[model samples]
Target: MSILLSVILPVFLVIGIGFLAAKRNAISPAGIDGIMRFSQGFAIPVLLFQAIANLDLREFDLRLVGTFYTGSFTCFLIGMLAAVYLFKREWEDAVAIGFIALFSNSLLLGLPITERAFGADATQANFAIIAVHSPFCYAVGITAMEIAKAHGHPPHTIPAKVLRAIFSNSLILGITAGLIVNLTGLPIPTVVDEGLSMLVRAALPSALFGLGGVIARYRIEGDLPTILFTLSLSLLLHPTLAWGLGTAMRLPDEAFRSVVVTAAMAPGANAYLFAAMYGRATRVAASCVLLGTALSILTAAAWLALLS
Candidate 1:
């Protein structure tokens, strides 16, 4: 209950404020777009860069990464197979559905929730997971999408396509630069580091508010069954797998909490973007992003309580 009030509610309150503001026409759509662009494009990337650049490379745990990603991949496969075999979705649409399950809101939801539940200093595992998150999810999602569209075409072009898609992202660029600094021990000037620190402080709140406003644009109108199923994969199955695996591997409390909390996040807006990018299942993806986020408020609080 304390966790719900202190940790979860504040985060959602900000989101709710944004939702109301947008719904009431208090903030123009262009204003919401500007907020999202600043947060997603600039502030969040700076946050990631600072976190990754300063991370202790020695603390990078394979078990932690494996636990989180194994869960993600499992959910992806389950979502994809079920979308096709059970829901009678087309292959391309199935792939898009799978991606909605795979791409958790690790940045917008994971970081703040974990930081609030644990503490600011306890997010190294989260950073480690996030460092590779976009690349890994996009790779799997794009590869599957291409294969679905190929109809048995040779996959020789898939790697390049995946690289192009992932690298083109600003978040990926920030991560890449962070890795370079971490590995090479390059020094960031004190003034620039301070500037980035200022930006990092604005990242989560701004992004969360922007996310809520963006979600307000989506209507929960169709594909109810598929949306519910994908939500199950994302909010339930993914974290269950991580929890089981993390326990089996005896992950330390911090790492265990990080992986599970991150896994428990709702599908990100990127899910809808991926669906739109492929021109498949866009409505379903949009609905999932909106409804799944609403559901995750309770689901995430439950996970935090159990972890406690």
Candidate 2:
């Protein structure tokens, strides 16, 4: 209970504040965009970089990463198949649904929640997962979208394109730099470390507020059944799959807890962005983000209690 009050409650309170501000027009969409950009481009990268730079790379567990990612991939495939066959969705739309189901908001929501609930080790685990997550999820999504749109004739330069996409991402750049620092055992200058710490302090609250702002802007305008189905997959099945796979693989308690909390995260804003860009099932994707984030208060609390 103290954990919930100290950590989780504060997070939601900030989110609620953002939601009310947006609803009352106290902040413009531009303000929300700025908040998100600052959080993602600067604050979070610094935070992640600092964490990764300090980690013992040799002791990092690739097995835990493999297990969590594999479970996400499995869920993606299953969601895509279900969307196509059961929901009668077009291939492109189905792909969007699949991406929404698989890509948890591991950075924005997962970082604060896991760090608060499980402390520094869990934060380290969360950073490790975030390092490769976007690239993997985006790679799968790009391929599916290309195939669906191009009728099986995707660009011949896919590998180059994927490589560029992955490297161009700010989050990946942070992870890469951190990996370099860790592998080489380079010392961070005291000045640089102090600067990063200052910037990192802004990440969590800004991210939570930005999350609420995003959700507040999302308008649900889709078939109820499809929206509900994807919501179920995102909020329920994804976490269940992560827990099952993590336990089945006999991951350490901390690692397993990390996986479960990450899996329980709301649908990422990236999913909604991808859907809007593809112009397929945009409503469903946006609804997933909005509803998933709103409802996650309860689900996250339950998971935290169980973990405790």
Candidate 3:
């Protein structure tokens, strides 16, 4: 418990300070753009590439994959529905809420913590699910948003627009490219490998710090209820759901424990960053992020203890 809390506390403190800073008109979103871009474009890809590359594809199980996907998909769908419905908003607004609500920060926060608590196997399980997550966010997640955004506009070509969004997404393209490299089993040149390694090294800390910078600029005054609601879904509801789903699926103990805790432990999905980037309810998303991140330390610690 102490070990888990020790890791989470500092991470969120930076996030909290970031939030307070944001509220105070320090480190505005524009100020953090470079940090955000570098982390998203360069660093996160390195982290994700190494993760997927290290995965033993032979160990990939369709049944296990099905079970994991079932859990993720269900949670995402349900959470989003709840959020949108609760907000008394339009379907597009609901779609945005659903996208963020359904997905946790499985990549940045979940992966590393799972690695620490459970080992590579647990981390990889989440990674496999997350590989699915990355694609889904690009395809299904964004399409929902784009469709919502376009509904009021004059009738236009839907398929072309959808394709454009998918093809143009750097994260989607990066993951697809990385997976292709991993699946092909080609030997990477040392120089290329080193180059990738350097980028990956920068990805983790830079992203963390960038997240800190974003938080530094967050405003949380009127959004407290939304913050609490999202936290309940993330730190509490999501874990409970994962626990129930893991049991029904008959997952192994480590896998079961890891996913249950990880689903709960992960910070708000960086998709919140997307919300702000596009200027969609940025304050709401930012506030949820700041609060969710701040509470994660205690909540995660409490969760670790309960699991033990």
Candidate 4:
């Protein structure tokens, strides 16, 4: 109960503050660029480096990694395909919806949340998620962007053009750096670790606040039916799929719940930006992300306690 309250309450309070502030017209998305750089370049890289550097890979479950990522990959593909079938919009928009529904902010909010939710013993599983987050985003996510471009404006130089589409992505870069250091058997000195910690401390608030700021500027356009239809897949479908798979794999209830419930979390790993940059329904994606993120705090925390 204490763990649930401790984890859920702070996040709720932040959202509450954000809701109030948005009502007051104080929020703006202009500072978003700066927040993006800070979180992507410095804060995220440091957090990943520290997490990866501290990890003793031998302590991790090899099968768990395979299971989790396999589940993630499957979920991602299915979401994409489902969006294609369901959306009356273009296929490119469908692709964007798919990625956002399946992927998450594994490095940013994921690491800290998993640590707080599951403690040190679960850290390695959390790291496994972090490790996959960037690579998956780059590989699958960039491909989705290309689909968008092919559907819209075509850039010069095939590969370079494709690379440019995803080049500005910092989360992908940061996770890659962390993986390199982790794989290289490098030792991070105490001073470097301390610096890393300081940077990581800002990741959650900046991102959540940035999201809140972005949402404050507009009202949702759809009626209840449209909103529920779009969001239900993210809130219900992916998590249920993950949960079914996790249980079949014999993951303990808590672990099963963690991975499954978090899958339903806001499509965190840069999907909204991808949608906006790619000229899909930008407002729709943004709206989905905001609502999904706010809803996830309750959904996830409840799942954690229930499973525990």
Candidate 5:
């Protein structure tokens, strides 16, 4: 109960406020888009930049990374296969559905929830997971998507397409720059660091609010089975696999919490974006993002309790 009240509710409250504001026309769709652009394109990237720039690379554990990503990939494959075989979706739609299961809301939902549930100091593992998140997911998703779309075209072009998609993201640019700074020990001026800190303060809250507005725009369409399947993979199976892997590897307590909590997050808006990008499974992707996020409130609280 405390976890629900203290950790989860506050995060959802901000999202709910945004949802209401948008639904009530208190915030225009253009205004909501502007907020999302500011948070996702600018503030969140700065937050990630500062976090990675100063992060102690030693805290990165191969076991932890392997555990989280293994679960993610497993969910992706399962989602894709089920979409193709069970639901009879197109190859392109299957790939998009697979991506919906692949990506989690690690930034907006994962970071804040872990920080509130654990402590500020325990988020390094989260940062480590996030550092490669967009790049890794985009690489896999774009590659699969390109391959599905190939239909006997030359395979060589797929690599370039994947690379272009990965590198073109602003988040990836921020992460790549952070890696350069970290590896090279480049110094950020004190003023710039302070400016980033200010942006960091606004990152999660604004993103959560914008997320709510975005969710408000998604009407829960048909394809109930596909949406439920996505929710199951994202909210249930992914985190379960993470928890089992973390335990098998005997991850440290902090790393265990980080991996499981992050895995348990709902499908991010990126899932819908990926579908929209390919113009496949857009309805299913949007419904999953909406319903999965709503369902994750209870599911996340349950995971936290079990972790405790």
Candidate 6:
């Protein structure tokens, strides 16, 4: 109970505040966009870099990494297949739904929340998840979008586009730089480290507020049943798979707990954006983001209580 109040409550309260602010127009959409942009471009990257730079590389576990990735990718495939077969959707639309089904808001929600719920050590495990998350999800989800849009031709430009996106990504850049520094045993300057440490302090709340703003702005706009289905896959199925795989892989308790919390995060903001970009099944994407976030307050709390 104390854990729930101290960790989970603060998380949802900030999100609730943001939701109210956005819903009431206390913060304009453009303002929300700016906040989100800063979080992704600067704050989060700095935070990730700081985490990775200071990481004890001895704790890096490839088996845990493999377990989480396998569960996540398996969820992606399952979601894709369900959308195509059960929903009777076009392949392109199904691809977007598939992305919504499995892509968790691991950064904005998972990191801070996990840190609070589980402790500082948990963030180390989370760093592993964040490092691999975008690349894998984007690769699978974006490839599906391209392949479906191409209709059997498969766009020639995809590889370059993906590479460019990955390399140019701020989060990935931070991770790469940190990994390089950590591997080379280069000392981070005190001033530089302090600056990043300061910047990272703003990452959590800004991210939650930005996420709430996104949720408030994107109204649910799809078939109710389909939207609910997507939510189920995200909030329920994904985490369950992660837990089972984590157990089978014999992840240390802390790592397993971190992985489960990350897996339980709501559908990501980018999932909705990608769906919009492809101009297929945008409603389903939006609905999942909105409702999944709202429901995660309870679901995340449940997971935390049970895990604790």
lDDT of each: 0.93, 0.83, 0.66, 0.63, 0.94, 0.84
TM-score sort, best first = 5, 1, 6, 2, 3, 4
**Candidate 2, residue 194: CA error in Å?**
0.7
TM-scores for all candidates: the values are: 0.98, 0.94, 0.83, 0.82, 0.99, 0.94
Best by TM-score: 5
Q: Compared with the true structure, what per-residue lDDT tens digits does model 3 show for residues 1-308?
A: 56655656555554556556556667677756786789788777666676677677776655455655555556557656766676665665565555555667776666666665556666667767666666665566666667777857754666676678666766666667667778898677899889888988777566766677776655676646555665576678778777777777788776666676667754454657557545665666767776777677677777767766
Pairs of residues clashing in candidate 4:
none
Indicate whether candidate 3 or candidate 4 has the larger TM-score.
Answer: 3
lDDT (10s digit) by residue, model 1, range 66-100: 99999999999999999999999999999999999
Task: Please give me the total number of clashing residue pairs in predicted model 5.
Answer: 0
Residue 45 error for model 3, in Å?
0.7
Taking the tens digit of each residue's C-alpha lDDT, what string does model 5 give over 210-275?
A: 999999999899999999998899999999999999999999999999999999999999999999
- Deviation from native of the Cα of residue 193 in model 4, angstroms: 2.7
Local accuracy of candidate 4 as per-residue lDDT tens digits, 153-219: 5654446754665545565566566667778977778897787788878876765555555555545
Model 1, 139: alpha-carbon shift in Å?
Answer: 0.4
lDDT of 3 at 272: 72
TM-score between model 3 and native: 0.83
Error of 4 at 174 (Å): 2.2
- The global Cα lDDT (0 to 1) of model 2 is 0.83
**Candidate 3 wrong stretches, greater than 4 Å:** 13-31, 63-69, 83-85, 120-122, 149-156, 266-269, 277-279
- Model 1 residue runs over 4 Å out of place are 152-154
Model 1 poorest ten-residue lDDT run: 150-159
